[model samples]
Target: MKPEDFQFMSTMLKQRSGLVLNEDKAYLLESRLMPVSRAHNIKGVEELIAEIRKTNNEALIVEVTEAMTTNESFFFRDIKPFDMFKDHVLPHVLEKCAAKKSLRIWCAAASNGQEPYSLAMILKEEAAKLAGWKIEIIGTDISRQVLKKAEQGLYSQFEVQRGLPITLLVKYFDKQDDQWQIKPEIRSMVQYKYYNLLDSLTALGHFDVVFCRNVLIYFDQPTKGKVLEEISKLMPDYGMLFLGGAETVLGVSDKFAPVAGQRGVYALTGK
Candidate 1:
């Protein structure tokens, strides 16, 4: 890809999804967008760029942006965060909201449904403890294509093995041909939607716990701040926020602070 093409896509990505692609990542753009080129029947990235330049259709621009951002992810791709969710966050929320028997969890950048499905499995395992509780686990991403796959809850053997424990796999998934399909009950626990972080929060409602992990590392500072601010608005005063291992609320927003004894967990400091 040409340097100008990289810059153009980077600008478009930042504008469309708040993801900042640096110059060194020109190779990544080539790797990800090559499929977009082929899908659109273009010969190469250069041709794709020329075609993008020819269009004013907002839908066309959205397709280019979505094509660039469809990252590969699986159930509990990083184990520690889910561990934290089950051990620390779930326990806390369960105790605090016992009276209501209702809980809302959101996986903001859930790619391929793995994260939310993992949570569903955890809840299933603790069925006795959460008896009669109303659980709503919502998974949202910028890519409609990925969300559709997520909603399907089918995973290849290789895809299921990534960070998935063999015991839970056997208990929660059923074999369909060569692939594993998440059980209908577990699949129904999560609601999937196409959501761009660049957009407003009014339509997303609010959550008791929000998992916006691993996404901020790709954004510029201003975009990160804006996204975090929007996230803060969608959480309760005492809600929890989970970030990637490398991310934090420090210097990003004053709305949250790291939870004691927990690595990536943040307690709402909006108090």
Candidate 2:
């Protein structure tokens, strides 16, 4: 691939999805976009770049962005966060919202629905406490493809094996041929939507809890701060944010601070 092509792609990706691709990932562009090119009957990455430049095709642009963004997910990934949600966040949010009798949770960059669904299962297990309350789990992702999979609520056997326990899997999922599908009740608890984290989040309204795990590491410092700041605005004083185990808000933004004794969990500053 030409240097110009690499630069164009990297810049476009950063602008469109906040994904920073350095020269070391030039090979990744070739490997990932080659299939997209072939599927569209384009010749190669060079030609793909030329076509995108010439036409500015919105569909093609979306395809390219979706191809580049990672959609890796599994149920209850990195267990500790969910443990915190159950043991800490949920009880606090429940008490805080007790008078309102409603709760809203957002799973940003929610790929294939696992994270939100995991929360749904947890909520289901606590049905007695939430008997008369309204609950909403909103799962959003930039990739429409993954959102479709999430809406379908289907998972392969291998997918179910990862990070999912036997008892919960048996209780919540029904075997459909070889793949397991989450029961409709649990599936109905979450709603999926197409969203880009870089875009304004006002229309989505407020959320009491957000899970934006493993997404900020791909962005540069400024983008990270911008996203964190925007997310902070969407939460109340007591709201909680869950990030990837490797990600943090220390240098990125002052809108949030690490929750005391909780790794990968953050609370709004001054709360």
Candidate 3:
């Protein structure tokens, strides 16, 4: 790809999704977008770039963004965070919200919904204790294509095998030919929407827990701060924040404090 085209797409992506693309990332773009080029019947990256410049059609923009957005995820991708949630956070929240008998959990940047569905499976196994609680699991992502797949709650065979235990799979999903479909009960437990982290969180409402993991590493510092601030706005004083193992809240925002047991889990605190 030409330097100018690379620069243009990088700028466009950063402005739209808060994801930063450096000059060294040209190869990354080429490898990821090569399939998109082939799918569009374009011979090379140059032709794809030309097509992008020729049109700003909504469909084309979505196609390109879908091609660009990272969708790498797996059920219970990291065991420790969920362990912390069940061991520390849930216990605290269940005790505090016992009178209300309700809980709200949000998985932001919920690419294809593995994180939320994993949580649903966990809750299903521990149903006895949560019998009376009103559970709301909301999953949101900036990519429309991903959000649609999340709502369907179907995973390809390869997807099911990755990071998912056989017991949980047998318990929560039904086989449908080549795909594994999350059962209706688990599917109905979560709601999904298209949400850009750059947008306001005023309509999202406060949540007891928010999983904004792994998404921020792609963003620049300013964008990271903006996302963290927006997240803090919709989180209660005691709400929890779960980030990627490689990510952190320290020096980025003061709205949260790291929880003791979990390395990446953070709890809302006075900022």
Candidate 4:
């Protein structure tokens, strides 16, 4: 891609999804957008950009943004967070909301359904503890394609194998054709939606725990702070934000503070 073309694409991605793409990442645009070009019968990224530039088509622009955005995920992509939830977080939430006997969790970037389903398994195991309680797990992603797959709750051999233990896999999944399908009970626990973090989250209401992990690293500092601010609004004072182990809220926003002794968890410090 040319310098001007790269700049246009970068600007478009930032405006549309808050993803920062530098000149060095031109290759990323070329590689990810090639599939979009082929799908639209455009010759390549250059031709696709030229056509979108000429027409200013909204649908085409969205398609390009979705294509460029990374959708990589796996079952319990990081192990420690889930462990923390089961060991520490859940007890605190239970104590805090003992009267209502309800809990809500939002998996902000629940690509293809693994993270939410993993939560579902834990919830199932603790069903006795949460008897007659209302548990709502909402999984949101910007990609409609991934939302569909998440709702289906089917996974390839490789996908299920990643981070999934053999015992739980046998208990929760059954062989269907070539892929493994999560049982309907687990599938029904999660609600998947096509949600962009850049958009309003008020429609989803409040959450006790918001797992917005491994996602903000793609944004620049300003965008990172903006996204964190948006997430903080949907959480309670006790609500916890889970960023990637490498990510932090130190200089980003005053809405959260690192939970003492917890590596990746941040406690809400602002409304």
Clashes of each: 0, 0, 0, 0
Name the runs in model 2 displaced over 4 angstroms.
none
Residue-by-residue lDDT tens digits, candidate 3, 1-271: 7888999889888888888888887787788778888987888777787788888666766677777889899999888888888888888888888899999999998899999999998888879999978999999998888889999999999999998999989988999999999999999999998888888887988898999989999998878888888888887787888999889878888888898867888887877
lDDT of each: 0.86, 0.94, 0.87, 0.90
Q: What digit string (tens of lDDT, one per residue) describes model 2 on residues 49-72?
A: 899989999999999999999889
lDDT of 4 by residue, 205-226 (tens): 9999989887898889988888
Q: Model 4: what TM-score?
A: 0.97
Tens-digit lDDT string for candidate 1 (75-181): 78678788888888999888888888999999998888998998889889888899899999999999887888899999999999998999989889999999999
Model 1, residue 201: C-alpha shift (Å): 1.1
lDDT of 1 at 87: 87
Would you list the clashing residue pairs of candidate 4?
none
Models 1 onward score TM values of: 0.95, 0.97, 0.95, 0.97
Task: Kindly state the number of residue pairs that clash in model 3.
Answer: 0
Which residue pairs of candidate 3 clash?
Answer: none
- RMSD per candidate (Å) reads 1.4, 1.1, 1.4, 1.1
- Whichever of 1 and 4 has more lDDT, that candidate is 4
Candidate 1 Cα errors over 4 Å, as ranges: none
Q: Give me the runs in candidate 3 sitting further than 4 Å from their true place.
A: none
